[model samples]
Target: MNKFEIFTNELLKWNKTHKLTNYNEDEIKKQIEDSLYPLEKIKDSKTAIDIGTGAGFPGLILAIAMPNTKWYLVEPLKKRYSFLNYIKTILNLKNVEVIRDRVEKANLPKVDLITSRAVMKTNDILKIIKPFLKKDSTILLYKGSNVLDELQDIDASIISRGNRNYLFIKGEKWAK
Candidate 1:
């Protein structure tokens, strides 16, 4: 079995008890697809951070995809934080750093990219990530149908796949 197979099995086992996620195997597979769909639009980053990496939606998945990039997965909740760390160790992912704290308290350095999935509103995320962004940084937010409402006053590029909205915002566009 591959790493993702192991990841799915572990997630399923933990979900039964800790309820790390409400998604089943098939649903989680769809989420993995949704998480990776925006890779084409993202810039190659040396370091990246994922806020509220609950059940490792895009963080762990992206870490697996982009092993060359350093990834920090932040989760305030204990169960999910444990899961992320466990996955990191099990997968032998040297590029992964599991942070057991809220994004605001993590006090991480500026990174080349920041990602979040269903974490918060676009503007709210910008505020939190302002300190962890470089001028050429990029942000990839996985949002739902209400993404348009969230982006009403925010400048971002959007791509829709099913009901998922991939919001892409360049640091230069948002940092100003």
Candidate 2:
């Protein structure tokens, strides 16, 4: 099996004990695909952070896909952090760091890219990460079909790419 397959199986097995994700095999596959949809847009970033990285979705998968870019997986819960750390070890991932703290409490450095999924609303995310975002940094939010509605009052632009809707918001400080 490929690295992703191995990761999936291992995640599922660990989930049995830890309940990392509620997704089944098919759902996991779909989530992985969705997580990777923004890869090209963020491929050139030197550093990236995944906030609330439950089960290491985009962070771990992105780390596996992009070995050169450094990744920080920020997860608040202890159990999820342990699982992410274990996955990082088993995958022999040298470019990923599993952080066991909430984003607000963690002293994270500015990053070229920030990603989150099912974590919070657009405005709230922008507010929470405002301190960690640079002027040219990009924020990629994974949202469902109601993305348009979610971004209705937001000032940022929306870009549709790769079978997924990504809310692309950029600024040093967004009007939240």
Candidate 3:
């Protein structure tokens, strides 16, 4: 089977014991598609951090798709954290790093990109990831129909497909 298939099977197996996600087999498959949908629209990042990476939505999937990009998948929940680590090992994702902590708590370097799927509001996310932002950094937020409402005054561009809104925001972190 393919790597995606292997990853899904492992996720479903772990979910039985860890209850990592409410998604069924089909939903998981759809989610994998959802995770990869941004590749065609965005440029690649040299380094990235995925916040609240539960069951490895866009983060792990993106890491798999962009193997050259260094990916740090930060998940706070114990079960989810363990599951992420397990998948990283089984998949032999050399560019992926699974962190067992909240995004705010984890000690990480500034990255060229930040990605979060079904996480939080656009503004709040910027606040949380402020320290990790560089002038050329970009953020990709995977959202739904409420994306426009959530964008508010944020100067972010959107690319919509089906129910998903890929919010692309440029980060500007000037040095002190």
Candidate 4:
């Protein structure tokens, strides 16, 4: 099996014990596809962070796919943190690190990109990651059909990519 397949198998196995994912097998497959859609946009980024990385949707998968980019998977829960670290070791993923603290509490350096899925609304997410973003940093949010409505009030330029979207807003654009 490929690395993704192996990762999925392990995820499912862990799911049975920890209820890690809300997706079924088919849904999980689709989620993987959705998770990878932002790869092209984030390809040039030197550093990225996945906030609230529950079950490692785009973070772990992205780390596996892009070995050269440094990735930080921030998950506050102990169980999830342990699971991510376990997978990181199992896959021998050297590009990723697991942060066991909330985004606000973690002492993280500014990154080129920030990503999240099923975490929070667009505005809320933007607010949460603002302090950790640099001038040119990009935020990729994996959202559903309500993406348009979610971004309606936000000032950022939204670029649609399949089921995912990128919010291009500089630090100054953020409403304080």
Candidate achieving the largest TM-score:
1
Clashing pairs in 4: none
Candidate closest to the true structure, highest lDDT = 1
**Candidate 3 off by > 4 Å:** 173-176
TM-score versus the correct structure, for each prediction: 0.96, 0.91, 0.95, 0.88
Q: Rank the candidates by TM-score, best first.
A: 1, 3, 2, 4
In model 1, where do residues sit more than 4 Å from their true spots?
A: none
lDDT of 1 by residue, 136-175 (tens): 9999999999998887767788899889988889887655
Reference-based TM-score, model 3: 0.95
Give residue 152's lDDT in candidate 4 (0 to 100): 72
Badly placed stretches (over 4 Å) of model 4 are 157-172
Model 1 CA RMSD to the hidden true structure, in angstroms: 1.3
Residue 115 displacement (Å), model 1: 0.4
Predicted structure 2, TM vs. truth: 0.91
**Span of 10 residues, lowest total lDDT, candidate 4:** 167-176
lDDT of 3 at 153: 73
Query: How well is each residue in 1-176 modelled by candidate 4, as lDDT tens digits?
Result: 88888888888899889999867778888878877876776788889899988888888888888888899999999889999999999999998989999987888888888888778888888877877888777777777667778867666666676655655555546523
